[model samples]
Target chain A: MSRTSSDAVVVHQREPFLRGFGSFVADVWAARTMLVSFVRKDLMIRYRGSALGIAWTMVKPLVQLLVFSLVMGYFLGFGDQIPAFGFYMFTGLMLFGLFADQLTGGATSVLWGAPVVKKVAFRRELLPLAAVGGALVNFTFMGVVLLLAYVVTRDFPNWHMLGLAVPALLITVLFGAAGAMLVSALNVYARDVQFLIDVGLLLMFWLTPVLYPWSTVQNTLAENGAPSWAFELYMLNPMANAVVAFQQALWPGVDEAVANAAAQRAAGEPFIADFDYFDSAFATRLWLMVLAGAVCLWFAQRVFARLQTGFATEL
Target chain B: MAADVLEPGVAVSVEGVTQEFSLRHEKTLKGLLVSRLRGRHPVAERFRALDGVSLQVPTGSTMGLIGHNGSGKSTLLKIIGGVLTPTAGQVRRRGSLAALLELGAGFHADLSGRENVLLNAELLGLSRREIAARFDDIVEFSGVEQFIDTPMKFYSSGMFVRLGFAVAIHAEPDVLLVDEVLAVGDEQFQAKCLGVIRRFQQEGRTIVLVTHNMGDIEAFCDEVTLLHHGVVRAQGTPRTVVAAFRGLLAEDERERRAQSAGGRDDPEDPDLGFVRVARVVVRAGSGRPLDAFVAGDSLVVEATFHAERPAPRFVGTLDLYEGGTLLHSTSTARLGVPVGPLEGEVTYRFTLPDVPLGGGRYRIAVGAAPDTGSPPWHQVGDAAEVMVALRAESSGPFALGVTVDRPTRV
Candidate 1:
């Protein structure tokens, strides 16, 4: 028998919450420490063993840019048409890599952490969040590389570009967290997801404007005398909005330090306006990202919390 | 309960909790499809794994959870450790909790042993600085310092357990849970664990240990909770609960022997059944069945079997086991048993004269079949009862005839 000491705290579950949103807030707040600790562990463990160690965290994107610049820039001759075209391609690949890593890793967190779920009880969503958290470290590194590229080629640093990266990333994090929640939960019911994710990622890769820029697509559309309303269909691809923001953040442009040089190609202007191009697109991409990000985060957390309560039994 | 008694520092309290899990009827692919089509949710097939289990332990008590596999001992421990939530009921606790349910559950195979230790410590809620402080202790305690730099994939299972156990116990939870016995890998490691446990107990930390070994129950636990079939069968001092636990095992052994009753040829005469053995209980020949044995006392191995009808020279097999290992086997046919009727239960008691086995739990099985010519592999009467006993001052390796031989001192 136990005596109720002052330190003996009990978890009180009341009859009902005011509504749906209240419990979500409570669950997240209660589980916040677990989330932070879990995420930190993920990031640390990923970079623990390499010879280059944490430096490799930044090198993957740098190497990807170099490889892409050499092959695409030299052979394809696409650089002649666009300003510092190699930077544009590398920027696209970097963003795509981050998105791909997050979705794929987040989706598999539940399956991979099945042992922890079945054997021990903790907040289950952290498993996936941890996975995405690992990806975010990589994204952070990639973001630095983007800034470095600006230092190397641009006239001066435009810190305003931080706007596009920060909010756009918040949007991406929500989508990733949601995807992890859904995937991890689904993994419990059917194992087919373990393999299907790779194929799905491959398809989404081609669907996003990762290796190619949207400007080229819009240029083709300009021949039709108007921006391609058709190119707007691509934004429906979910992660496309994040890619748009990345292009806007890392676009090759000169600032006040080199305005004379910038005017060699109308540096003050970003891109010729067209609803089809990412930079000149409709105002909805930002809001679309916000709405999708919030919905996905809310939905994913709720699903993970509800589903994990049963995971020990089901597993 | 007194108000001051219920004040701060009570480690854990559990009340009226029940947990159920389903055993799917058919493991077949078609069976899965059919079950899904029938709209039979998992609820239709689930079994209650734990039923209305309640427990409480003070802040500084080392408690043992004793039960057979599937008896819900581990399940209850998991719930108490906060690794699992009860489907019904509630648990309350004070202070932080650390559980070693599965040692090394998070260790990655590709990582070096050193890296894994740090990673596992962090996983168990220790910070980097704390891990750094205890890193050497962990390595030395595990006795894997030589292989610390090597990948874990290269380490032996014993090495793996060492690393896991060292990292876990060092983290030092206010409340700790241990599952299964520690005798599987090595003698040296087991000794170290026992030492660790004893120290932990003296410190008055709350620890819940789940093991089938009664020795661990008697040695470490001040109290024990006997779980049976997803329920708390008994709860009391280690001695009392252990008695009840043994009683439950005896009942199960008898039931098994009863089902294997009639002879193979004749299924009609339920009463006059096969000479399949009924039970194997140990006695000191003192009329009363002692729970443990003196190191050099006579151990009487009693085997009871049934005889359905009269038969020719048939062999009866008896195998003695300690901690699930067969120590010795003997057949009655070897002693020239010609013919006997398989009509009623017969008891064969073998006097060991001196208990040679070391400290551990043991079970015996007896069965009657045919001749043992080819490999002595046939068995008919296949029933047994588990025996939990401790050997006093017994040493290792096949009845050495002495505890330890000391060299002559000049």
Candidate 2:
């Protein structure tokens, strides 16, 4: 084995504020193989002993869809009002599942990797990043299951709007990564952060447009005489925008419901309400929020870099 | 900070590195909030583990760090390995580095040995291609090829440590930081590890080792540094530095004995100040006072006693002990040596010819009795200590030299 003359010489000290970002990013990039190893380990260990193995990943989402379709479609009498209501609801929950998995898994990533973290010297950010990777794998499996459901029902989604899901998933991942880095580092100091994240996620589930579509929230706000900025503020949540984007991509009835509402309004007949999937400022707000999420992720990474110097000692 | 400029031969240089840890009094958030609400601020207790410690390891040289527990040897090693960022100062090192701080520290119990080796080698800064190339060599060296696919939780502790050490040694780091992890597994494996370290030295890799086993230090270290209470006490050749460490240990033992006054000083003495054994000393045949000696060397024991009043027929006794067990006992009367009427201070000398002792510290005790079958006027336990180094390649409480004639088909 030949030793490279250009071997990097590292100088370790207490890093000043944002001074070592370039080298830190370089180190993270260099350790990408380790990140893949950790992600693979997590996925393999999660389903090592089960009878069905990786089939378990698809089982949970299918079961949830089955239960929701039975209770919400047949028992609630709303199946006639909305087409494929269970699938629409399942589409929103599927993306939200990715967010929730990333949040909780990333929050405990550092603590869970304590044995490796305390002994080895590598880019510690990989711990939380690996958790995000594992969540994305599960998200892929759920996406495949959703596609099969659409095929069985013979209701293809809007092909033109499906490209929105890419940016929507990107924003969700950014937000998840930001929250993960922030809490994972803080959790090393105080274990209460993990519990607080659990409660916060429960609250966030209702606030985001997961169980109900964005139109119901808009209808409620209009009836309550809320200001227009209130509508903008409600849509400011990244998860809310992600759920709407998923609906525009996967749920086939979004445009039909909008057309039916317009026709009913012209005839002066009672009709189920549905909002425009693409609002006037939708693209601008979507990309702007992506920018905002990137800024939050950068800031969280800085906080993580500063706090990680104490992890070995504190843990 | 400006970049450091190292001398040509220096591979690792630590400049005034100081590490301090703040130990928080409150462990939980709720407890911290409650204490703050009561207007009682729980202060963080700061502990300085390493204070202004600076050392340089030249390329291809092995340096050993020796100290009592909590003396910051491991902390310094961690700082050098970049596992910890020093609170102050900087550690600059060239080339790749790996720290075998704890065997199997990076292994997952649930993962198979093969998988763990892949992960662990990558964690130690090895590339995927490098690990794949050396995977067979690592498994062969570890001697666990039969169970390479089994999860580590099922492996024996010895097998686990062997595999961990095997993977780390194959990482091909330019500088290695080892912290007392060499004395794992059985003796055969330890020797194998030592052989690998010797090969590393031959290949001109710098090593910084931390261990309490002075034998390992003396055997492997080119130079040694002694740390006492987070400060470097001495640094130089292994012989001088290890001697200084021994002196420090003896001083600590003296201080501990002095603190437990009840055991060192007899309180319920009826003949309180009538007579007392003032001191005891051990000397070589050349009349030189030495705390260490080779086995089978002539030793002279001298005990000085002081009497306030006239006392006749006083008997003096000398006892040699090893760790609370008495090995030999002799008295002036037993040896046919008589003492005069004791009125003032008197010194009694006992000569031992060709003593056979093993490699360990032996304590000497002396006492003065009024007469045979009478309570001792004064006695001192742990009066002095002498270290006996083995003369031949032998072990145990006594070093015995043996000879065997060639067997002729008997």
Best by DockQ: 2
Worst 10 residues of 1 chain B by lDDT: B374-383
Q: For residues A1-315, write the lDDT of model 2, one tens digit per residue.
A: 333242335457456776766776787788887888999988887789999987887787678777767776667655655666877888888898898888888888998888677777778889888888888988988888788888899988889888878778888999988888888898888888889999999888888876666776787888789997887788878989988887778888877877877887788864436757546677677778788888888888889988898888887
Give model 2's docking category.
medium
TM-score of chain A of 1: 0.76
Model 1: CA > 4 A from native: A1-6, A9-82, A113-121, A155-162, A194-238, A254-288, A310-315, B1-10, B22-40, B102-105, B264-410
Task: TM-score for candidate 2, please give it.
Answer: 0.84
- Tens digits of per-residue lDDT for model 2 on B162-219? 8878887899788888887776788888889899889989998989999887767866
After superposition, which runs of candidate 2 have C-alpha atoms over 4 Å from their true positions?
A1-8, A11-13, A269-272, B25-27, B35-44, B102-104, B263-410
DockQ for every prediction shown: 0.22, 0.54
Superposed Cα deviation of residue B362, candidate 2 (Å): 12
User: Model 1 compared with the native: what TM-score?
Assistant: 0.72
What count of clashes does model 2 give?
0
lDDT of the candidates, in the order given: 0.65, 0.79
